[model samples]
Target: LLPGDEEPEVDLGRLLQTVYERAAYDLRVRYEEEPVPPLEPPFAEWAATLLREKGYRRR
Candidate 1:
C-alpha cells in the first residue's frame, strides 16, 4: 500500500452491488426467477433525494 494514502468515502452498498454484478457469472450466482417487479416511484425519488443530500452521489 502507498504510504499516507487513504480510502475515499463512498456508498458501500452500491459499490458492493456493482462488484457482485460483475462477478456473478464467474461466481455461478443466480438471481431470483420471479417476474419483473413494478418500479416504486416514491422509492426512486427518495433515493435521489438522499444521494443529493450526501453530495458524493453527484461526482
Candidate 2:
C-alpha cells in the first residue's frame, strides 16, 4: 500500500512475488560483472537520502 490511499483487496502473495521478481531483475542489471565502480554509499541508502531531501517522509 502507498502512504495515502484507499484500501482495496489485493493478493499479498502475488504482490510480493512481483516485487521480488522486479528487484531480482534490477540487481542483475546493476551487478552483473560490471567494469564500472559501484556507487560509494550503495543504492538503498542513496535512494533514501535523495527521497528525504525531496521532502518524502517515510510512513
Candidate 3:
C-alpha cells in the first residue's frame, strides 16, 4: 500500500520464521563439512553456548 495499490496484508511472523530457518540450515551445513585448525578447549564450549542461546539445542 505504498505508491502502487495492491493488497493490504503482511505476515511478519511468517517472514521471520522463514528467514530464521534458512539461516540456521545454512549454518549447519557450512559448519558440518568445513575443515579448520584445532581450536582451544574453550572454543567448543563457546559454540555450544551460542547455539543454545539461539534456541538450537542439539538433539
Candidate 4:
C-alpha cells in the first residue's frame, strides 16, 4: 500500500505453464511407448489414475 514497495518478482503463470507443458510432453512420450497397467487397483481404477495424473480432473 506504500509507494516504492517492490512487488513479488515470481511469474506464477509462466511457472504453471512450464509445469503443464512438461506433463504434456511426458504424456506424449508415454503414448509412444507401451501402456503399462498396474495389477492392484484393476483396469478402470488405473485408467482413472492415469487421467488424473495428466491433469484431467473432471469433465
Candidate 5:
C-alpha cells in the first residue's frame, strides 16, 4: 500500500508479515552480537486481533 498505488483491496497477511520481517531486521541490526529473540504467543494474538479489527472496522 505505497503512496499512489491504485489497488482497492488489501492483503492483511502480507502486511503483517512485512511488519514482522522489518522488526526482526531492526533487532538484528540493533543487537549485532545477540540472537534475535523468538516471538511470544500472547503478543502475536494481540497483534492479530488488532489487525483484524482495523482491517474490517469500516464494513
Candidate 6:
C-alpha cells in the first residue's frame, strides 16, 4: 500500500480483542496437560541477548 493512502479507521479495542483471540487459538494448538518442552530459560537468554544487542540496559 502506498504511504498516505487513505485507510479505514481502526478501533483499538476491537483490534486488541482480535489479537488476543488469535493468540489463544494458536496456543491451544500446542498446549498439553502434561509437562511441555521447556522454553523459559532459552527464551530469557535470547531476550537478554537481543536487548543487549540493541543497547538496552537491564534495570
Which candidate tops TM-score? 3
- Could you tell me which 10 consecutive residues in candidate 6 have the lowest summed lDDT? 29-38
Candidate numbers sorted by TM-score from highest down: 3, 6, 1, 2, 5, 4
The alpha-carbon lDDT assigned to residue 53 of candidate 6 equals 75
How far residue 40's Cα lies from its native spot in candidate 2, in Å, is 34
- Please report, as a residue range, the 10-residue window in candidate 3 with the lowest summed lDDT: 29-38
Give lDDT tens digits, candidate 6, residues 28-49. 6422222255558877567556
The C-alpha stretches of model 1 lying farther than 4 A from their native spots are 1-7, 25-27, 30-59
| Candidate 5: regions farther than 4 A off | 1-7, 25-59
Q: Candidate 5, clashing residue pairs?
A: none
- Report lDDT (Cα) of residue 6, candidate 2: 86
- Model 6 — TM-score against the truth? 0.31
Q: For all the candidates, what are their Cα RMSDs to the real structure?
A: 11.4, 12.5, 7.2, 8.1, 13.3, 10.2
Error of 4 at 47 (Å): 24
Overall lDDT per candidate, in order of appearance: 0.59, 0.62, 0.65, 0.64, 0.59, 0.62
lDDT of 2 at 54: 61
lDDT of 2: 0.62
TM-score of each: 0.31, 0.30, 0.34, 0.28, 0.30, 0.31
Q: Model 4 — which ten-residue stretch has the worst lDDT? A: 30-39
Task: Give the per-residue lDDT of model 5 (tens digit) for 1-59.
Answer: 79999989889999988987978854544322322464378865565566557662222
TM-score, candidate number 3: 0.34
Model 6 CA deviation exceeding 4 Å by range: 1-39
RMSD of 5: 13.3
Which tens-of-lDDT digit does each residue in 1-59 have in candidate 2? Answer: 78898899999999997997978864564332322555556775666566557655351
Residues 1-59 of candidate 1 have per-residue lDDT tens digits of 48898977899999988987888753562222211463388865565566558652452
Query: Which regions of candidate 2 deviate over 4 angstroms?
Result: 1-7, 25-59
> Could you tell me the lDDT of residue 42 within candidate 2?
77
